[model samples]
Target chain A: MHSKKVRIITVFAAFTCLLWIFGLGWTVKDYLIGAAHSAYSPPAADESAAQTNELKIIALGDSLTRGTGDIEGKGYVGYVTDQLKKEGLDVSLINLGIKGLTSERLAEQIKEKEIKRQIGQGDIILMTIGGNDLFLGGQTLTNITDDSISKLEEAYLSHLKAILADIRAVNTEATIYLLGLYDPFNEFPEGALTSKTVRGWNSKTMELLAEDSKAVFVPTYDLFQLNVNDYLFTDHFHPNEVGYRLMADRVAALITSGGGPR
Target chain B: MINLVQNEMTKLLGKRRFIIISVIILVLLSMFTYAQARQAETIKERLGTVDWRTELQQKIVDWQNRLSSAGQWREQLQIQIEQSQYYLDHDINPSEPGAPTFIRGFVENSAELFLPLLIMIIAVDLVSSERSMGTIKLLLTRPVSRFHILLSKYIALILSVSLVIFIFGLLSYIISAFMFGNQGWAAPVLTGFKVEGGELNISEVRLVSQWQYIIQQFGLAWFISLVVGTLSFMLSILMRSSAAGMGTMLACLIAGAILSNMVSSWTSAKYLFMVNLGLMNYVSGTAPPIEGMTLGFSLAVLAAWMLGSLVVSFAVFMRKDIY
Candidate 1:
């Protein structure tokens, strides 16, 4: 019979061996699953390579890219892809939009060791941000006087400029289409201060885009406001599936039109 | 002193009791080994025969396309691809003279889940079984000092538990190796898997022999099991009934597991035993629970708990009236 202390210690050792070192194939499985949860699980190797590059566009944004407000979750990204394919454009679309990410965060992700390979030179980049800036700052963003407006605008534009810089850095020849903020406040009944700031931010976005020849500004401001209640997700702010489809379709059109200066 | 301990143990583990327990331990170990083998079979079926070379290529392709696809995971896809490519490029598959895939599996699975359960089963009744049978009185009547007797019984129980566990380990290793052979002891390891803020990453991925992994796992499991065993044994002494001690400790163990699962949101619960069960997570470099606690924290918590239990157990044992 084993001494109780020694027996206990042995049990500990044995259990340790079992959990920590037992045939480790299981650990690999755990690792794989964990990796899959956050990272992309690429298509099976057997997947046929793209037949042609009629146009391979990856939409990178947040809820809008995800079709959050849409009934079917087919945000504009899907719509644009469908429209382009219908138009005989060979297009492959990848949507890498995480909810609740600010432009700062999205840029950080772009700089990751991982995103480098996903973006391609000559590929079109469709990006939508500023929703979170509105969500987090809300009415507080509107309180800026002319004196502070310039200061705040400088800060906001600097961040956007940094993000745009990253997109170019990652994909040098890529055309970056930055979607301005939609007017979710149009349907905001009576008067909400946050709604006014949403409009101000949209103007700011357009103003910022005017300085750059390459950064095309897609005006989603007028579109979502037309059917604020129906096109928006239940949250009443982010575009619903239909709204996203519209956004995606708009960007797809711009990608094809090769939009000239307004 | 020896007489008291012998009398206590003789009555506690009556000839029939001794045989039954020994059989039970052996049977449990055997069943556990059988189950482990079955688990390996299941993995083999799903993952396709454990050929790491093929698996690596498959992973690389999968990772490459994942980055190419858009689900807002483009960045992560890049990282995952690079890591997989690193392994494949270096030719460090699991079969390439390293810890077999199972040892890698053990490292992932060892934290907080299996180790505690084993300790719970083995040590919860180390003292209470005798007390529950009301044999403490008879033993106390002998001239042997209670402390001496308790110490000897403790030694014996520890020995039995250790042998049972070692055999359990050996049986599992043999059963798995029967199917895996050198695959059991050699395979490359990838330990950088992380899920923070819903983000994932991986690194290191060096090759270590499965045997070495087993040894490492053995050391880890021993430390964890010791913590659990000490705490449960103390509980057994305080409760004086096998069922009560076992039931309480089992509940506690289960609670720890459940708490660990949900504590990511609760955050503060990380200080509790439930969140600490998978203390190995810290060592494995998964983010610590509650944003800060490490393996060291969990160890300290277990140590404190054990020390507290010991104080209570000793105080009660040293002073309680035998009658």
Candidate 2:
């Protein structure tokens, strides 16, 4: 009986090792073949979609650009694309937004070759910056002095000018829409100060956009100005689906009203 | 004492159970390798025509942009970009798909869970099966002391644990190296990733050669297996049946893995023996299942449990009469 069990054990061990050898050999062979080939290439534009007047929308800037705080994971970018589709326009969006992105980082990002290339390829560019600068990178909203907001506004304007210049350098045709900030702490004690700071920043952004014909400052303060809680996500920073949908509607309206090439 | 250990070793080697368990682990590991390689193939297909250098640069920019924005997962993304930037600056491509570095990554990933379970299968039956087969009387009647006999069995258990781990590392290296080519051992890898107060503590991070990383990883894996093997060994001695020992040990291990994720905020969960088993997470610089679990704290907990089990195991075996 001991001998029989030993024989069974030996066979089982040998069989398993054989399976190991075979499986590993096959996988490694596949890996080798794969490593020799080109890993990825840009997708070719579909002729049918192009015939339907496909619009390439490049969304850039902060977490609002990346669509965080929404359980659906579809930030304003998704809603904008969906609304465009509803209007019988074929749309392809390239979102290059990062979380915690400041105006300075977005300025630097526009200089990257791939991002430059992506921006050049777009018919429209959507941006949400300066939120981090004023909010202090989502740290706190209660501590606000007019002096700090002015300093931030100065830095943000220079960065925004540089960003627009860089985008124009790459592609002069894409319409740039910089979204204005909403007062998330509308119910807080210093909410009034925050509202004043945001409006000051938006007016400055609008003044900068006036210099460029294709650049327009899209306002979002009115949408959440009254019912801030309903529009704001649970984080009290980013917009919920309802908020994103409102922004998307404004963007779609801009596009329909000569925001881009017809 | 040496002869008794030799006898124990032979008894272990001669059994079909040990071989069967080893084979099962081998099969599972190979399947994992196969799936990993398949995934690499699709990634390779997706990366068509883009130079890896350009891709790496693009990834760095993406990480930078992510870090600069106010959003969730900032710390984790920052660490990844830093690691990638290190590789970029050094001109070492650690992201080579299907490479040995990639395969070695899976070892550390699986070591915390799969490796320990494999070692448990060999250990849970060591003493209980002997008692169940009525062979304890025959062994105890010999001139050797009961302590020597149990000690020999324990040594044999350790030897088997070493063998299984050796096979796991060896087979993975041989098969992956053969396919991916024998490269990347000298490549530098970033280590010492740590978190504190729900934020990444960057001060602890460092860079080490891939070879050193592999050695430290295996050492940590072996240490974890020792704790697991010894715990199951104690259980095998206490329980009268091998099935009961194996079942209880398995349940405890699974529960510990699950509870580590769910009740990590529960301060007392840190004291559980299985909670301390993921010591590799600390060495690898990933977030621990629970916050504030340092390497020293886990090691001390494991050592105390090991010593306690050893004392209990010996006390019971020496006093209890053979059936």
Candidate 3:
């Protein structure tokens, strides 16, 4: 009986061994085949730029641009797109926002091999970025450049420029509207130091707008600043329904005016 | 006495159970490690292909911009963006999931579900079996006293239970190393991930060493299993019939385990032996469960219960009218 039990145990052990071996081998093969396929046929960017349309818009940068955390939590993209439809404007927003992305991260995404092929001439590029970078004390330099509030601002802009250059590399004739960083700090009445950093950041944003008139600067600073208590939420940051509506109105007015492609 | 335990240990050193359990663990570890290695290699192959993060973020923001923002709510999104930004700045992706968490160690984690049955198989009929065959009465009639006979069997039971726990833990340790890699040995465990509104929040804490972690994890399982085995041994003595003892203990063990998860709201249920099954964590330096009976408290409760059963067994075995 003991010998019989031993034989049974041994068989069970051998069977388990065989199962693991074949299963491991299969896993390796699946990964190898997937790797080979990706290499053999690289995923290319979409070539159809919707040339039949009178206007083409690309929404770029982080979650805010992605329009995920709005009041409906569907975000600003659908609302803005629907509002655009309200006035017969041929438009489509090419969404390219990566969550947990700073300006540098966005720059990295912009340089993706597939995205380069998709951006085209005469496209309208709308972007909301740099808020994440600024909030994280993204200041790379210890000394503030009068040109920028903190030395890191210099580094941050270079990253932004790299992102811009990447887009321009693909579509030079596209009109890019850079939304100036709003005073999310305005709600923080007691946060004088943080507000200074916010003021300094906003200053640099305006200066960049002056530098490129062809690039329209949509001022969101005032939209979120007024009735700061009423517009702000319990978190004392971001926008409520009133604030998002103001944002939609600002963007709609610009596109309705047919802001020319720079 | 220690040497006797050690000698019994050597008897099990090359036993089939030891060899079989170890190899099973090693093979599992190797397979998981190899698969992960291959998958990571593929990810590296297409490292520069797609910027999934930006694409995801863009989707979030497009949704953010379109939705009609309501009252005092924008502040929360601001915090989300800021918190999301922190992860971005650090290049950390907390959402990437794999492997059971550290507290829930591989071997012992499954042990709760299956280890109890294995223990019952070996230990249920331990003392009762000798009596069932009338061999125990023959031994008692010999020159040796009843205490010595009982003590020997008890020691043997302890040794066997310890070996099983060690083997179970050893298998998990070696296998996880293969599945997760050496890096995973040091991989951060989000001990208790806090999820709100379908989002996982990462808190600040240092990672514990893998080996030390395994020791603590095994320690907990052994303690719990020891409690379980001890209870079965006590039951084995009280009941003259091995089948009766094993069946009753098995039902109680199963019922205890099932009740802990199902009727969690019952405050009185905390005293149940099954609820204290996580005695593994107690010995390993973790905080007690919500309003849990403490380690000292639980050990005392189990000890009293065991001592009480042993008292009843000694009295009945020494003087009971057995046919």
Task: Give the distance in Å from residue B224's predicted Cα in candidate 1 to where it truly belongs.
Answer: 2.4
C-alpha lDDT values of all predictions: 0.58, 0.73, 0.55
Q: On a 0 to 1 DockQ scale, where is model 1? A: 0.05
CAPRI band for model 3: incorrect
Give the worst 10-residue stretch by lDDT in candidate 3 chain B.
Answer: B187-196
Instruction: Output the chain A TM-score of model 1.
Output: 0.70
Provide chain B TM-scores across all predictions.
Answer: 0.71, 0.88, 0.62
Question: Taking the candidates in order, what DockQ does each have?
Answer: 0.05, 0.07, 0.04
Give candidate 1 misplaced runs (Cα > 4 Å).
Answer: A1-57, A66-75, A78-95, A120-124, A131-136, A140-162, A172-177, A187-218, A249-262, B1-113, B126-153, B159-217, B234-240, B254-278, B285-323
Better of 2 and 3 by TM-score: 2
What digit string (tens of lDDT, one per residue) describes model 2 on residues A1-262? 3555544544444444344344334323322222233222223422122233568788888889878876687788778887887888767666778888889988987886556766766789999998888888545465577777678889989999999999999889889988998888877787887788788888999999999998988999998999889988888888998999889889878988787556
> In model 3, what is the error at residue B304, expressed in angstroms?
3.6
- Alpha-carbon runs more than 4 Å astray in model 2: A1-59, A67-94, A99-126, A130-156, A162-262, B1-3, B34-96, B174-182, B194-199, B262-272, B288-292
Against the hidden true structure, what lDDT does model 3 obtain? 0.55
Candidate 2, residues B114-202, lDDT tens digits: the string is 88788888898888989889888899999988898899888777767666766777777776776667777766565555657655565
Q: Fnat for model 1?
A: 0.04
Q: Write the per-residue lDDT of candidate 3 for residues A1-262, one digit (tens) a residue.
A: 2544534433443343343334333323322222122112212434454345446566677656654335774345445666776787655555666544588878876765445554553367888888777765434224333554565577778887787777777786777777766665654444455556666777776676565555677777777666766665455555566666677777777876777322
The predicted structure with the larger lDDT, 1 or 3, is 1
